[model samples]
Target chain A: MSEASVMTDELRKQIGVAGEPLVVEMEKGMLRKFVDAIGDPNPLWSDEEHAKKTKYGGITFPPGILAAIMMVGNRPPIEIPLPRGLDGGGEWEFFEPIRPGDTLTIECKIGDLVERQISMGKAIFIYHDTVWKNQKGQVVATSRTYGLKY
Target chain B: MAKQLYYEDVEVGIDIPTLVKHPTTQQLVKWAGASGDYYQIHYDKDFAIATGLDGIIVHGRLKIAFLVQMLTDWIGDEGKVKKLACQHRGMDLPAVDMKCKGKVTNKYVKDGEHCVECEIWTENPEGRKTAPGTATLVLPSRGK
Candidate 1:
């Protein structure tokens, strides 16, 4: 059997660490549902009149709305089933506003892999990074996700 | 419905508007559909309990959306959120109200962008910070 440390390094080199691309469409219903489900009553995302008056000139996505879109999917790049995924938090950088009907293609890779001994036992902290680009090939946003798996 | 925050007007130590949100299992269900993170830990109470959680917990990303709202609402339409980062330190269960808050930490101008940095977090009903992080923004200057 492989030691935990060795397993961690090997997983980093093999999976999401291998750097792969996943594509997903940014749908309007999904975007609206995300804003509504979060209990956000922002007119900019819902009310057409309010959105039309804003700089976007139409409904726009909230900055963190991508969390719901990026996560939840069984896409490759970071496809390791380590079971317990503890929340390590995430970082987001926005370049352009995501408008309605835009398709986003993501390129993801694993960043840092460190082994830690916690109260629960031994775990590996995985840093996942993904860049989001619009169909026009413009970089729209990027995120670095932090997760812990044991 | 909101005034734009001008770069010259905001000072360090200013507070972003606070947002208090109460999440429910139904909301989590909706989130599950939207995010695709249908991990039972967020919606299945029985499975969560069997796994040792108090109950089905709110998705940490959902809490992040609430915090993002606070920051964006405070800046109004003219400002831009350049970066946001947070780490989930505590679990937040549904049915409890969480407070999303932020305070300015720094202000500066770089590359012609009037930038501001603030510390942001969400506090569970028990008054413990469940998520803590930082955000950077660029607001339009009155003259620029």
Candidate 2:
């Protein structure tokens, strides 16, 4: 008996294909909620007065907020045959500060796929690349997230 | 908040201040709500155990948040995080002490930007690195 390959031809076709674009508005309430969940006491993310004195001149969301924002929009789902999935980690590059009232367009796509043997036996790693652009059409941030299917 | 860290002030191989976090089940719940990642393994212990985990595990993204906080706090308000990359190699249980630590690896001027690089990671109580990563920061130069 032999195990079937998790990376089928159909799955391989998804690589480099862009998904639907998602637009999200930066709201103070949502930013606060995200900062609160992280338990970070940075005044830049909470206190308007304190942030006003900083170079940012107003409250700014932390880079960590990307973790939450990336989850808000829907993307085309790539069905994998693996039973369990785990977050393998991610890489992010920031080019702008996210502030309240800024509308952002997020585009995501499957960057690549690879198969490897791990302690869990066999796993398929899917890399999702996401780009965030502000209303000005400036690229604010880009991230690559890895998901492990085992 | 700490004093601003300038590119001139950072020395290669020096350790940055560490940020320690104690993540409880309640915090995990808050994270699940905030992140929109209501994965049962992060909040429901029974479901997590059913999937072969010891119990509920801390969210990997939450640990990434901790590491980001550590870097931002070290860089101060004038600094900016340019890039961050990490790998989730191990799982952490709730209520455990997750220590975020980093050491400056290199510094240089690129495209007229003062850049500093560091090796960052979160360590379990037993001194094992659960999530190891690297970060690049742009700090204000004293000359400017």
Candidate 3:
């Protein structure tokens, strides 16, 4: 490995280390803003009248709302020596609908690390595994996010 | 939201309705604010160029959100998205047409829930699959 490689002992040590739990309350206004930004006109996400008639009986956010919640919530940050980082996409498994007023506690941990030689030179891929539970302690969703640092 | 898509209606090899998006810098700014990414590479052209990118690029998570919207719209109110996975293979520039498309890959009843699986992706204007992924959805049964 070159001296400039972003994969360091410190980053490797973070693998499998869990971060502090982040609690986020799903707010209707925030959900509206998120859906609006996506340009999604789904009434279930915004129109209270339409949402009240649905099975959820209230505004239930789209699955993508989880991304907003996770992105904005506070979590331990991995210090990569690299100057730039890019999102490598993610995987999500949803077990229940997230409705307005639901309090979700998200727990995250570094799952793994891999070093790859790319056209841009050496890069380190960090995998984070996160679990989302409701106030009732039921796992509403679990996700894995991939981040590339170079 | 044309009609409620029932489990019996979906079949392997069928294509889901496509959603086309024309993402602009304004939309990216809105997304940055709402998503709290605040990454200059997504909105600041000069910063993105300095970082070696062509220019400001679309947020990968925003594209993922588009894919999610397509799935949710197709499934309608009665259906639920169970699992989704995506990989950002290439960067997409602003003001480009990105089409979100999917095709059913599998259908089955597991654990009393009617499930459907699909191969989903966001295709850039060049017809390249920039963000390829898979999704699992639960659709209501017509028999029930």
The regions of model 2 sitting more than 4 angstroms off are A1-4, A69-72
As for DockQ, the candidate ahead, 1 or 3, is 1
lDDT of 1 by residue, A21-115 (tens): 66777778877778878878777777888889878898888988766645323334444446676878889999999887988777777767777
Instruction: Please give the lDDT score for candidate 2.
Output: 0.89
Select the stronger candidate by TM-score from 1 and 2.
2
RMSD each, Å: 2.4, 1.4, 1.8
Candidate 3 on B1-144: residue-level lDDT in tens? 467899999989999999999999999999998888788998988999998989999988999999999999999888999999999999999897999999999999999999999999999988999999999999999899
lDDT by residue (tens digit), candidate 1, B53-107: 9899999988888888988888887788999999899999898888999999999
Query: What TM-score fits each model?
Result: 0.92, 0.96, 0.94
Clash pairs, model 2 backbone: none
* TM-score for chain A, candidates 1 onward in order: 0.81, 0.93, 0.88
Q: Compose the digit string of candidate 3's lDDT tens values, residues A47-106.
A: 889878878788888988776635424445788777767778889999988888889988
Residue-level lDDT tens digits of model 2 in A9-111: 8989989988889998888988887888889998889999999999999999899888663543555588887788888888999999999999989998888
List per-model TM-scores for chain B: 0.96, 0.99, 0.98
Candidate 1 CAPRI grade: medium
Give model 3's docking category.
medium
